[model samples]
Each structure stands twice: as structure tokens, then as C-alpha cells.
Target: MDKQEQALGLLQAAVESMGGQVRPGQQEMVKHVVEALDEERHLLVQAGTGTGKSMGYLIPALAYAQTSPKPVIVSTATLALQSQIVGRDVPRLLESLKGKLSRPMDVSLLKGRSNYLCQYKLGGGYPDEDEGALFSMDEKPPASGTVYSPLANEVMKLREWAEHTETGDRDELVPGVSDKAWRQVSVSAMECLGSQKCPMADECFSEMARARASEADVVITNHALLAVSAFEGLNVLPDFDVAIIDEAHELQDRVTSSVAGALSARMVLTAAGGAKRHCAVNVDELTKAAHRLEKSLTGIPTGLMDKGLPEEMGIALNDIVEQSRLVLALTKPEANAPADGGRQTARSQLQAIMDDAIRMLETEERREVLYTTRPREFVDGRGYVESDPGTPATLNVAPLSVAGKLREGLFDGRTVVLTSATLAIGAQFDSVAGSLGLMGAGAPSWEGVDVGSPFDYPKQGILYVAKHLPKPGRQLSAETLDEIEELITASGGGALVLFTSKRSAEEAAEILRPRLDAEILCQGEGSMKSLVEQFAADRDSCLFGTMTLWQGVDVPGDSCRLVIIDKIPFPRPDDPISKARTEDIARHGGNGFMQVSATHAAIRLAQGAGRLIRSVNDKGVVAVLDSRMATARYGTFLKGSLPPMWPTVDKKTILGVLKRLKP
Candidate 1:
């Protein structure tokens, strides 16, 4: 049989094995994926919900891996989807295809180094300067601040577990400890002393994971690690010739984060502390630079630093660069000097600070974007203008455009197939393709295929736009809250209210709880999993949340009959990255708002509205309280990105329909 036929046959078997019917979209997706892999071409597939997209690609990936000497890599955006693929889908597919292939396929879930335990760190061979106090087995805090210190109680528990665990994976541990505690036992990829230098080189958990992935037929990882490996040139995963990106839309953001660098007062202090003993010059100079950096950062308003930093901040940054440089030059170890893990680590830390501190003022190369961020707000969501600026502002630098880098580093050299339910925004893949470096002038040749969803959207759901409500602003609107209350009452409390901001969600829940009959559960009041489970279990309960609730949440059946959006989920106006990118686009004679801001809002709006329907039997109403969705000229573009739900604007009609939809 041809590859297409073979893939389809495998998919059919997988569907039957999972007790599911074969979907036409899934069949089409499998054929396209197989062709893409065989031809070594770039392909973008928009496979809507219920398309069985995972099986569609996996069946072909299995076939390709068997034929090629290289393993296939699959990257996902969320932990939930990764878990679904690793914990459920891949196993079922393998079970169906058992004995049908030349040899059994091995699927290994490979995570970044930090996810696995570092034996060197656990063995007390090296401790980060910030964590030198760790590895003590003392049960109690140091009495009267004496020098006699012992290992933390939590660290002792981890050591006990380390002695018997096989995989040495943090996820395998139950009743997980805090990040502060975990950092003591584990090391990041950069922090660890390599096998050649480390005494515990044998049987390293991270190394063991890489060895498994290297031998496996398929390797699965998240976008974060994929970005680091692909763009940052980090060896976070096993080498592969082909990649299947499940959530293709999140690629740009993930890559940006992986390559981005930040400099802060905390980083300065930490670097200085680490380099003290190793510094040939007086470490006091570096400490003085840290304080100078903090003073310069004080009272600097936080936003995009497109034009430049304040004169004082610039001078302070220059001082940091020089001081770090001088220290590095003076602290070089002799060529044949004994391998001291501590000294080696200190130099690496200092070098990173110097590089980023220089990048903060990088203006000649327009390829990077620079911004400043204010310290996090107090728990009350308020901040005061203190003279000291308690916490210094952080300066960040990120690639302004990752397209060229991705094109050269990823898409150009490999066969890549990107699939997602929302890949085609407004029925076109041009936007997402551009972001992934598969489109535009001189970009790699690529094709896009749209495999429509199985569910009949027009019949399964309604898109209700409240055009008369007041526009969202600095303050929450009473009319919007009134509309929400009426909808919850009419729908009999099966509502998922999505707000643009956490503060707004809290305010809405606070105002609605006493007036509504249903048990109102706010997002932060409980864990998201527990809140979502409770909401799904009780038909008369309402769960209100922000961005976290927009995607990766599935609530099928009558329990989620109403989805209320407080507003169009746009990038925050003051967002530094957004401002910088928009300005850059505008400078290049482009419509910045349309390309950057509106597209962002449309993608998120689609994701939020998607929460209303999860299965073929699901029937619900997506109520968008923002009038702009119906009245603005860009409204058509935004609406086109969503599922083709039955559209309406009459409030009375929607309310009557909700009343009828009551469980």
C-alpha cells in the first residue's frame, strides 16, 4: 500500500481500538501528513476539534520513523495536551498497530534537563552560590543563628527518595515540594557540571533520559524545550529530521521566551555573590555596581525602552559591563588547573550577566527588542511610589522577529508538519505561517490544508454578541455585570465566565455570588483542576476565571451550557512587547494594529469561544459582552476566526434561548 493508504489504514485501526468512528477530517489529515513527511515539505494543517488529529499524525510518524534512520519529534504547547498524548493517545495507537510494523515502535517522553534530577547536585558535589546553605540534614532552623546548620527537613526527605527511585524524575515524586526546595536538589542544564568533570557521571538521570530518546522511534517534548534546542542551539532533545508541532500557533511566543535574556538587581547580586572568591579584583567593586544599577532603576517608569534607557540607567549598565569584563579577565584559571566546579560555574554566571547587560543597550541591531518591567504588584493589586523602589525594575531583551532565525535554523533543514485546530485564522494560514517562517518573501515553500471539524457548529452552539453594552475600560462596567447575572440566572448557573484580567474576574465573582443562586467558584479561590472538575460535575455551578480558562479546558455536556466573555481578549495596551512590535511594524509601513493587536485578539477570542463546545453533542451559547465584536469594522475579521456558531445580537432572544437551555 502507498504511504497515504498505509497511514489511513493505521488510523482506522487506531480509531476502532479506541472505540471511536473514523472521521473524514482525520483521514484527510493523515493523508496530508504522510505526504508531507515523505516529500520532505513543510505543511500546515488546521484540523478542528474532534478530528482525532493526534492519531492522524502519529500513524504517519510511526510509518516514517520505521523507514528513516532518524527518530520523529512531536512538540506540544501545553502540559495537558502533552499528558493526553503520552498518557493516552500514543499508547492506544501503538496497541492497534502492534505487530503490523517491521518492529515495535518506542515512544519516549523527553523533558528538559531541569525536569530530571542531577546526580552531581544531589550528591553535594556542587551547590549554586545562592543555595550553598542546602544539603544540611538538620531538622530544625539554626538555633540563635549559630554556625552549626543542617540539611533542611524537606531536602532530607528528597535525599531519602533519591536513594531508591529508578528514573530520578521530579514528576515521579508525590506530594511535591516547593520550587525553593527542589532547586536545592536539582540543576538546570547550564548549572550542572558535565559528565567529564562530575564524579556522578555514571547513571545520570538526565543522561539516561537522553539515551532513551536517542534510541526511541518517537520523541515527545513541549514547545519550550523545542524552542531552546531549535533556536537557542541547546541540546535539550535528541536530534531528529522531522518535527510535528501540535500547537503551531504558540511557537513564536515560546521561542521568544527561550532566547530572551533579562537583567535585574537580583541577578546582579547573585552573580556578584558567586564570583566573589574567584574574582582577581576586589569583589567590592561588583557589589558597588549592583547598588548603582539599583539606584538607576529606581523611579524609572516601566514599559518598552524603544527610544533608550534613562541616562543614569545607561551609565550604570556600562559600569556593570566593564566591571564584569575586568573580573572575567582577572579570574581565568590556569590551563592545567584542577577542575573546580564552583569556579567554573561562577565564571559562567558572570559571563551571562555581562552579555545581557550589554544587550540591554543594543540599538544598532533592530533585530532585538528591549523593555523594562515593574516589580510585581502587592497581593492587593496595588503599588506605592517608594523612594527606594523596594525591588529594582528589570531590563529585558528579546528577538524582535524570530522568523528569519526559525527559517534558517528549523524549517529550512527539516521536514516539518504543524497542526492545530486554530492554525488557520480567518480561514487563512498566512499569519501563522509568517510567524513560523514558512511564508513571506524568500521563505521556504509550504502548503496549508484545512480539514473541517466533525461537529456541526451552526447547530451545536450560538454566538451571542451584546452590541449595546458599554466598552470595557479602566473600570468594570455595571451593564456588563448585569448582562452576566441575567444570563447566569436564565441558564440556571451552568456558566463559564472568561475575563480579560484576573482582577476583573474576581470583581465579577464578588458581585455575582450573592445575587445568583448557583455556587460561584472563583479561579484563584481553588486549584484550576479542582475548580474545573467541580464546575463540570455540578450543572448549577459557575466558574469565573481569566486567561487560564480560555484554552486547554474541556467541559463537554450540559454542565457548560453558557460561555460568557467579559471582553475581547486583546494584548494589554501597555504590554512592552506588544508596543515594541507594533511600533516596529508601523515604522515599516504596515498596519500595526491590524497585524499585531487585532490578530492577537482574534486568536484569543476564538480560543475563549471554543470553551463552549467540546463534543458533537455539546450545545451552548458563547456570549461576548463587548459591543466592538459586532460594530467595529474589524469585527468581521475577528468573528471569522471563531467557530461558525449560530449568530445573534438580540439580547431578549438570547436570554429566552438561555432560559430554554436551562438544565
Candidate 2:
């Protein structure tokens, strides 16, 4: 049989083994993937939920791995998806393909070094003075004052697990330890004493995993790791003939973050303190440089530096660079001196600070954007704040567009197949294609295919745009909250209200919690999984949240009969990166707003609307209370990106329809 036919047969048998039927969309994805691999064309496939898309790609990857000289790398955007590919899909397909392929296939999950435990760090062991200075990843348990401490206990559990875990992967620990605890045991790529330098290198969990992955028939990794290799132009993953990227929509953002760097006042002070400890020279100059940086950054207005850093800022950074060099020269490790982990780690960190300072000063790089902003405590793509008067500003530098970087580094040498449910905005791949660098001249040749979803979107759902509602401003309008209440009351619950900010979600939930008859569950109240479980089990319960709830959530059936959006989740108007890119496009006489801002809202709106109708049996109404989604010229484009649900602006009709859904 031809490779395509063999892949189909394998998928068929594999689905049957699991007592499931393969969808037409899955077959089309597999066929296209095989052709893409064979013909050396990059592919973007949009396979909807319930299409068995995971198995669709896995079937071909396994088949190709059986015969190809190089393994196929499967990349995903999230740890959840990565875990699913490695722990579930690969094993199921391999079992069904047993004795059916040219050779027995094996696979490995490759995570960043920080995701694994460092035995050296855990045991407080180090190689003799010649090497193994200091290198550990992140985190520390909170200080305990009580008889029992949660973080401390978690750390203790990790120490116990370290003795028996063969893989040493942090994810394997059931009901996993806190990141704070994990930091005490793991090592980052930057800080890690490499296999040759660390005494525990032979038994290193990260190294062993790499060895296995290098030898496996298939490899699973995340986009962040893949982006590192692409931008750094290094072999982070084993050489592969093809790369199948799942959740391809997230690739650009991941790449941008990977290539970005930041310089902070806290970083400067910390480095100054460390250098002062290890420097053999008069430390006054380095300390003064650090003080200059901290002072220069104070009260710098938070926004894009359209004309580049202020003169004082530039002088301070230059001083730090030159002064750090002097200190580093004095502290340079001597050939006969004993190795000190603290000294080495401090030097490495100071060097890194200098490197970022240099990168930040490169204002001539037209492709990059630079800005000053308060540092954030990023969590769950929500809770993005840690603002205070004392919080010094940070200078951040990132690519204005990751398209060219991705085209040259990610797609040039490999047979690439990218897939996501929301790749084709406005029912056309042109917008997404251009953004991914597949449309312009000299770009790599690529094709897009929307296998589409299995769900009968129109029959299974309704898209209700409240054209009469007051326009949204900084806060959710009273009219919008009223609509939410009526919708919840009419449906009798099972509403996932997605908002643009935490304040809106909280205000709505609080105002309606007393008025509503059903249970109200808000995000960040407890664990997301726990809250979701509560929402899922009680059909009459409602869950309200921000961006994190827009996608990667699955609450099928009657439990999710209504989804509400407070507004279009556009990139903030003041977002420095988006603003810079928009200006750049406008300078070239393009539709800057439509291309950057509107396109961003389209993708996110699609993901938010996708929360409804997760399965063929799931029936719900996606209510967009933001009148802009109906009144704006770009509304049509945003709607096109969503499921082709029966749309309406008739509030009474929608209310009546929702009322019938009540038990």
C-alpha cells in the first residue's frame, strides 16, 4: 500500500481500538499531512474540535517515523496538549500499529530543562572546585511560621519523589508540587551546570530525557522550546524531517517572547550586590552604575519609546556595561583558584544583564519595538499585575513582527504542517497566512486547508449580537450586565461569561450573585480545574472569567448552553508592540488597524465564541453584548471568524429561545 493508504488504515484501526469512529476531517488532515511531508510543502490545517485532529496528525507522524531517516517533531502550545500527545495519543496509536509498521516506534516528551529536577541541587551536592559552580532553575518555598506549611510540605514531597522517579519530570508528580517548591530542585538552561561539568550529569533527568528523545522515533515538545531553537539558530530538538505544529495560532506570540529581552531596576540592583560580593576590584564604580540605572528608570512614563531611550537612560546603561566589564575582569575565574558556584552564577547573571542592556540599546533595529512598563506578575493569562508606586519601570525589547523570523528559521529547512481551530480569520486564511509569513514574496511556499468542524454550528448554536446595548467604555455598561442577568435567568444557568478584564467579571458576578437563582462560580476563586469541575457538575451554575476562559476549556453538553462576551478582546489601544506595528504599517500606507488590531480581535473573538458548541450535541447561544460587534464595519469580519451560528439582533427572540432552555 502507498504511505497515504497505510496511514489511513492505521488511523482506522487505531480509532477502532479505542472504540471511536474517525471523522472525515481527520482523514483529510492525515492525507494532507502525508502529502505535505512527501512534496515538501508547508501546510496550515484548521481542524475543529471533535475532529480527532490529534490522532489525525499522530497517525502520519508515526507512519513517517517508521521509515524516515529522521524523526518527526510534534509541537504543541500548552503543557496540557503536550501531555495529551505524549501520554495518550501516541501510546494508543502505537498499540494499534503494533507489528503493522516497518519497525517498532517509540516517542519521548521533551520539555525545557527547568521542568525537570536537578539532583545536584536537591541533594546540595557539587562537583569538586574545578567545575560545577552554581546553577539551579527557579523558586523558593514561602517562609513558614505555623506548625504546617503547604509549600514546605510540597517541597518535602518532591524530595521524596526524587528518589524513585526515573524521568524526574515535574509533571509526573500527581497533584503536583508548587512552582515555589520545584524551584528548589530544578535547573534552568542558563543556570544549569552542563552534563560534562556537573557530577550528577550521568544521572541528570534532563540529559537522560534528551538522550532518549534524540533516539526516539517521534518527539513531542512545546512552541516556546521550538522558538528558542529557531531564533537562536541551534539544535534544541533532535533533527527532524517534519514538524507538525498543533495550536499553530500561538506560534508567533511565543516566538516574539522568546526573542524578547527586558532590563529592570531590580535586576540592576541584584547584579550590583552580587558583583560587589565577588569583585576583587573597588566595587564602588559598579555599585554607582547600578544606582544610576535604578535612578534613570525611575518615573519614566510607561509607553513606547518612539524616538528610543532618553539620553540619561542611554548613558546609565552604557555606564553599567563598561563598569560591569571592569568588575568582571577582576572577578574572572583564576586557573588555579577553587570554583565558587555563587561567583560563577553571579558572573553569568551579570553578563546576561549586560547582554540585555546592549540589546535594548539597539534602537536602529526597525523590526523591533522598545518600551518602558511596570513589571507584571503573569498568571493564567489573567491577573497580569503587580503595580505599585515603588515598582520601578522596565525597558522591554521585542520583535515588531515574528513573521520573517519564523519563515527563515522555522519553516525553511523542515517540512512543516501547522494546525489550529482558529487559524483562518474571517473565513479566509489570507490574514493568518500573511501574519505567519507565508503570503509575501520570497516567503516559503505554503497552502491552507480548513477541514472544518464536525459540529453543525448553525443548528447547534446561535450568535446573538446585542445591537441595542450601550457602547462599552472602560467598564461594562449597565445595559450589558442587565442582558447577562436576563440571559442567565432565562437559561436558568450554565453560562460562561468571558470579560476583557477581571474587574468586569467580578462586578457582574457580584451584582448578579444575589439576584440569580442559580449558582455563580468565578475564576481565581480556587483552582481553575476545581471551579470548572463545580461548573460542569451543576448544570445551573455559571462561570465568569477573562482571557484564560476564552479558549482551552471544554465544558460540553447542557452544562454550557450559554456563552457571553462583554466585549471584543482586542489588543489594548495603548499596547506598545501593537501600536508600533500599526504605525509601521501605516507608514507604508497599509490598513494598520485592520491588519493588526482587528485581526487580533478576530482570532481572540473566534476562540471565545468557540467555547460554545464544543460537541455536536452541545447547543448554546453565544451572546456578544458589545454593540461594536454588530455596528462596526469590522463586525462582519469578526463574525466570519466564528462558527456559522444562526445570528440575531432580536433581543426578545433570543430571550424567548433561552427561556425554553430552562429546566
- Local accuracy of candidate 2 as per-residue lDDT tens digits, 396-478: 88888878877887888888999998898755787777877887889888888989888998898999999998889986678
lDDT per prediction?
0.83, 0.82
RMSD of candidate 1 to true structure, Å: 3.1
Q: Model 1, 304-394: lDDT tens per residue?
A: 8867777887888888899899888878877666656667668888888898888777754647887777655435543222233445678
Task: Tell me the TM-score of model 2.
Answer: 0.93
* Cα misplacement distance, residue 439 of candidate 2 (Å): 2.5
Clashing residue pairs in candidate 2 are 133-341, 134-341, 138-183
TM-score of each: 0.94, 0.93
Q: Which residue pairs clash within candidate 1?
A: 136-150, 136-151, 137-151, 138-150, 138-151
Per TM-score, the best of the predicted structures is: 1
Worst 10 residues of 2 by lDDT: 128-137
lDDT of 2: 0.82
